[model samples]
Target: MNMQIENNFSYHAPKPGQPEIYTAIREKAKELAYLIDEKAPNSREKSLAMTKLEEAVMWANAAVARN
Candidate 1:
């Protein structure tokens, strides 16, 4: 595998303060999830919105982990 690609695929252990950053990201995502659950009507669109929010959170975490 290419070195850059290998590096990208590797698990990155959290450095000092990184776990705190990850926790903050997750907390904010949770707050948005609560608002979505309370305010959005029960429908397919709302379901999709929730799914996308989950994807956003995963991608955000990956960005922090990889960079």
Candidate 2:
């Protein structure tokens, strides 16, 4: 039997100016993309979720750029 376990990974942004923070964000985005792909009920919902995630990453990048 193939049992699929649901993941609840939380992304915590690391210290500013550290590479770890970027890595963390990238990993988090990938996880979110996977969850969105797997659990979204329909294409519209999936598109919305992906758009939101993209916006969030852009916002994070902007914040980092400002610092």
Off by over 4 Å in 2: 1-19
Question: What is each predicted model's overall lDDT from 0 to 1?
Answer: 0.90, 0.69
Residue 57, model 1: Cα distance from true site in angstroms: 1.0
lDDT of 2 by residue, 1-67 (tens): 3222222233435455656666677789989899888888877878988999988976775455434
What's the true lDDT of residue 33 in model 1?
93
Query: Using alpha carbons, what is the TM-score of model 2?
Result: 0.62
Off by over 4 Å in 1: none
State which candidate has the highest TM-score: 1
Q: Report residue 5 deviation for candidate 1 (angstroms).
A: 1.8
Q: What range of 10 consecutive residues in model 1 has the weakest lDDT sum?
A: 1-10
